[model samples]
Target: MEEGKEDLETLGEQLYNRIYPSHKEIAGKLTGMLLELPGSVLIQMLQDESVLTGALEKALKALQLEQEPRLTNKNEDEVSVSSDSVGEQLFDLVDVYNTGYSQKITGMLLEQHKDAVLHLLSDPKLLEEQVNLALKTLKEQSVEETDVSDSSDTDDTERLGERLFSLVEQLDVLHANDITGMLLEMDPADLQQMLGDGAMLEAAVRKAQAALKTWN
Candidate 1:
């Protein structure tokens, strides 16, 4: 029975490694699935005080701990790192609006920069084009500004950017008309804050237009 239990645990570990690959954070999910297996089988295995069960629990805990650092590292990396410039950020904001999370972040942005948001939403294609231009400017700039005095402020900005970018990527996955409807309904202030600056706002609109032309 003990040997059989060991075999089961070994199989579970193998399955976990195959599914998660480099991501250890999914260990808890895998464990949850394992626990859902037939109760009778589990009980029968455990009747003899199996060491394999103990090992499995420990392995799951280890995976959780390993995953914690990776998650934290990912969040930290985003704070000081940006793929493009203020222009990219603008397109990213629109991108977020296309996603479900946009409402929350967009509401916050609208509370700060209502006019900009309205301008961007007025024409989705144009906004995307402008964003691409803004991104080009950011890329052209030699010096990257990464220093921030306030940690909280940095975190807030990072969160806003992430939410915005995630939305944009989601929009790219949707139908064009549905994407347009989502943008029209978003708050203007929110759009402005996500754009970060006036230049980015203009660039994003231009980029959107260019992209739309190519798509058509």
Candidate 2:
């Protein structure tokens, strides 16, 4: 009986080393599972190396599958938290000079060039360049859309103004009123141009947002 027990322990050690040479805890668990089999089954496994290895491989695969979602979710959560922290740091840097435009600019950079924003977080100069590039793009878009024509009536213009106000609010609610007031101060024709054309209105709001600090 003692000899039989020693043989079982020896077989368990060999199985553990063969299956998980570098992971003692995992190997021990697998070895325990293997040892739980009936004497006849254990004897067959002990007789055929392929049978023991095959059973271990199947158990390991099932363990991996069971753990996949949990591992994936943990990694995803870590990445999300890391990304938000990086984004906030970048936003504060951009906000120093740009003020209210920081959120919009940072959001644009993340959307258009996410890899750069995340990977270059340590390089403030490069991040500033990215912010400048995003601002330049917004300016160019605004310039392109500024050529819109307007022929709407007073009521149509009022409705358009309300819609434009709402759109600008979506950019940053805290400064929406101030930005809308700034837009209101534009020349009658320019204001009409923005209100009448959706693209023009969006571009105008973005332009106004970028230039918001200058007027302050």
Candidate 3:
């Protein structure tokens, strides 16, 4: 049992390292865009939590996030569960599909890392092997072959904002912090001031809302 546990942890670490990099890099871009308002404007926008939540929901949906496949613990007939999917299952704690829950957890993460709760919105991977491994777990748990899209390009960070959003959704909070560190490339203060200024904030928000129209 101890050896089996070690193997699971080892596999989990390998998969986490592979996907976490892509997850963090992309998460910065999507989160940065949303939090792009001025502190004052953010103070104002913060008044409407639904808008914030909706923005988050919008970003994830754009990423083409599908419902996470349900996991089965026991074998069904000839089917057997695989240990590989432990990676995807590990993130079950972060239920981004639940808009309210996503918002709440994000808020909690941001507060602990005020950098996120206060200034990190404007923000802003393979992703392939890991995703395939995750899908493989589902296929193993059931007898039927899982019909997942085999295209890694489908969510490879170059497409629509949604494509990136889908990738970011896979991240847990620790990865969020790591991504923010890299995003220091862009000045949060500058972005914040740009949004806080009445005119700039208004303009950016308008542009963002307009972009959402094409999200469908």
Candidate 4:
């Protein structure tokens, strides 16, 4: 019951975080049935190239990824089960033909740029060397160029808060760490600088961390 539902939500969260977007499509697009299946069965299919049950295959194909290979039966002595991985049959082939890169490459991009890669997945022409440059661009883009007409300290606080929130909304834990490290490495000035107070910036960072958890 209640515990089981909680457990499934946790599993869905973990699976959603660890599974690539494409593999997710291969797994019934995060359907409840996928979560309801035995962990051993899902693990078996993910790890080894096993024949998926009919319901599972149909569920995966419902998403209509480009290269879902026809499934074979284990009982057929003349035909061997698909040696290609469930991921390979679904996502990897699409990776080859569509993106021409692996999830590993995209994952490395995440390590470099946090959740930014999630947006970049649509760009098939992306190159690995361009990752850091994209991050710098995004970081710069976070700093809005608008002029605040109010000359009060309140306007300063609001403006700084807006800039910081803009950055955090795009960040995950890793990218937050990047900002933390950058902040720490820089010298400070006064209460009227960086933000209204150190506590405010700390609160913004915490908000980004909390937001990242929900994104999973």
- Give the per-residue lDDT of model 3 (tens digit) for 114-200: 222212222122122332343444335323212343444223212322322333334423233222222222233444454336565
Instruction: Flag regions of model 2 displaced more than 4 Å.
Output: 1-83, 112-115, 149-216
Give the poorly placed runs of model 3, Cα more than 4 Å off.
Answer: 1-186
lDDT of 2 by residue, 1-216 (tens): 699799888777766667676556688766775675445666677678877766666555434433433213456645443334444555555553332355556556544344455444545457656767776765564455455634333344356457656877876676565456456545556776666677887777677566543321
Q: Model 4, range 1-216, lDDT digits (tens) per residue?
A: 699777667666655554445465444354453564556555554554332343345444433432333324564555432211222322332232222223323223433332343323333234323443443443343343223233443344345434543554444333543233233222223323545555666765665345334433
Which window of 10 residues has the lowest lDDT sum in candidate 3? 117-126
- Cα RMSD, model 3: 22.5
lDDT, candidate 1, at 163: 52
Q: Residue 154 lDDT in model 1?
A: 34
**lDDT, candidates in the order shown:** 0.41, 0.57, 0.34, 0.40
Predicted model with the maximum lDDT:
2
Candidate 2 displacement at residue 162 in angstroms: 12
Ranking by lDDT: 2, 1, 4, 3
Better of 3 and 4 by lDDT: 4
Q: Specify the highest-TM-score model's number.
A: 2
